[model samples]
Target: MGGSNTSHSNLKNAVLAFLVPLPSILFYLTFLYHYQDDDPNLLSPVWKWCYNHPILLANIFFFFNVNVLFWLIGLIQSSHWMIDPYWTVIPVLLVHYYANHPLAVENKYNVWRSRIVTCLTWVWSIRLSHNYFRRENWQWGVREDWRFTDMKHQYGKCWWWVSFFAVYLSQQVFLMGICMPMYVIHLENKQLDILDFVGIAICLSGIAIAYFADTQLHDFVSRNKKLKELGKPVVPNLDKGLWQYSRHPNYFGEQLWWWGLVILAWNLGYGWTFVGSLINSLCLAYVTVLVEKRMLKQDYRAEAYQLYQKTTSVWIPWFRSPLIGKSKNT
Candidate 1:
C-alpha cells in the first residue's frame, strides 16, 4: 500500500509539473497573434514595438516559458530535461508563423521557400518529438535526465535556482539563435537563385542522413535489447552502418542542415542570419564533445569505442583517421 501511494504521488507530480508552464506560454503567443491581427500602423507603441520586432517578441515568449519551467522544476522537484522538446516544438511555431506571415506569403518565390522549409521542419519535429516522448516516458519529473542529475550533484542544492540560468535560459537562447535563419528567410531573397536550389539539395540530403543515422542507432539498440533478453551476446556500441563512416553522423548531419539554412540566408547578402547557423554548429560540436567525454568516463565498452574511433571520421563522412584499419581485432 505504501509503494502504491508513492507511485501515485509521483504520477501526480509529473502531470502537474508539465502543466505549470502552459498558461504563460499560451497567453503570450495569443497576445502576439492579436497584435499581428491589428493594423500595424494603428497599433499602440507597445504593440507597434512587438509588431516591428517579431523575433524579440518570440524571445520574450521563450524567456517567459523557460522561467515558468524553471519555477515548476523547483516546485515539483523535476529534472530540467522536461524542457527538451521545446527545442523542436518552438521551431514548429516560428516556422509556421513566418511562412504564413502576410509580408512573406505574397511573394511567390519566398512562399515556395517557406513551404519547403516548413515541411522539412515538420518532418524533423515529428521524428524528434517521437524519440523524446518514448525516451522520457512521458513521466516528466519522475524520470530525470542523467546529465541534470550529475550537474545537481556537482552543484549541490543551489542547482535548484542555478539551473534556470545555466540550463533552461541558455538553451532558450541557443534555440532562438539557431532559428534565426527561419525568420530571416521570410524577409529577403525575394527571388530564387542558384544558391537557393543548392541549399535545398544540401538541406534535404542532411535531413536524410540524420534520419537514417537515428534509425540505424534505434534499430541497433532494439536488436541488442532483444538479444540480451534472449540470453544471447549483445553488441556494446553501434559502430557500423552510417556510424562506420562518422563517429557522430547525426551531429554532422544536424550541422550540415544549419549550414544549408545559412546558405539560404546568404542569398540576401551576408547578415546576422549567418550567426544562427554558425552558433548552432558550434553548440552541436560542444554537445558532441560533451557526450563523447561522458561516454569515455562511463560507458562499459570504452575500449571498444576507442577502437571504433580510430577508423571513423569524427564529423566529416569521408575523412577517415590516419589510424584507420590499424586495429584488426576491431
Candidate 2:
C-alpha cells in the first residue's frame, strides 16, 4: 500500500545519501593507484585470496572501505571506529604510485616510487603513532582524541548528524583526495625534472615545518602537565619557539603542508588534488579562529594571553609590534 511505497522510497534515499561521496573517495584511491596484497589482487583462474589468506588480508583492514552508517553508529556509541582513522600516510603513497606512474606489468611494485613514499610515510606514521601509543591510557575506548570531543561539544546535539557528515566524512574525503598525488605519481607522463625536484623539496620543507610546529606545541603542553603533576611553577602561555611567531603555528604549518600537496599535484598536473587542500586550508583557518576565542575565555591570566596575542600573529608569521594590531581582525 502507501506505507510500503513510503518505506521503499526512504530506503532508496538512505542508500543514495550513504553512497554519494563513496565513489569519489574510492575513485581517488583507485584512479591513481591499485591497492595490492602480497598475494596479487586477482585470482589465477581458480578461487580467491580472502578464502586462503584471510588473516593477512584482514590485517590491512585499516585501508579497507568504510561507510557513513558506521560513522553514525560510532558517534552514537561514542566510538572512534565510526571514523576509523589510520596512518593514511601509506595509503597516500600507494595511491600516488598508480596515478603518476604507469605499471610495467599487472602486479609488480615500482621500486623507485614505492621506496620514496614508503620511507617518508613510514617515518611520519611512526612518529605520530609512537606518541599516541606512549600515552598512559592508550586503551581502545579510553584513548579517544579530545579534539573530537571538543568538536562534538561545540556543535551541540540537534546539529550532531550534520556535523558528522560535514566534519568527519568530509575530512576523510580530503584525506583521500590530497593523498591522490602520492599515488598519482604513477600516472605522471613526464620523467623527473627540476620542477619535480623543487616540488620534492617543498614537500620536505612542509613536512619539517608541520613536524616541528606540532612537536614544539606538544612539548609546551606536556611541560605544563608535568609541572601540574610535580607542583612546580608553570607557564600558562606558550609564547616560546613557534608560539612566538603565531598563535596557531601548528595549524598554519598543517595547512601549509596540505597546500604543498596541491603544489605537488600542480607540478604533476593533477589539479584535482587542489580540491582537498582548499578544504583543509579553510578548515584550518576556521580552527585558528576558534582557538583564539577559546583562549579568550581564560580570564585568569587575561593580560598574559592578551600580551601573547598583542605580540603574536594569528594565522601568518610576521613581526608583531606592541602597537599596531594583536589579532587577525586588527
Cα-based TM-score, every candidate: 0.85, 0.66
Q: For candidate 1, what is the lDDT?
A: 0.73
Query: Residue-wise lDDT of candidate 1 within 186-285, one digit each (tens)?
Result: 8865788899889888888788888788878878878988998999977867877889889888888777777787788777775667776777778777
The segments of candidate 2 whose C-alpha lies over 4 angstroms from its true place after superposition are 1-64, 69-76, 81-114, 131-139, 143-147, 150-164, 230-233, 322-330
Clashes of 2: 18
**Clash counts for all predictions:** 0, 18
Give the worst 10-residue stretch by lDDT in candidate 1.
135-144
Lowest summed lDDT across 10 adjacent residues in model 2 is found at 54-63
Please report the TM-score between candidate 2 and the true structure: 0.66
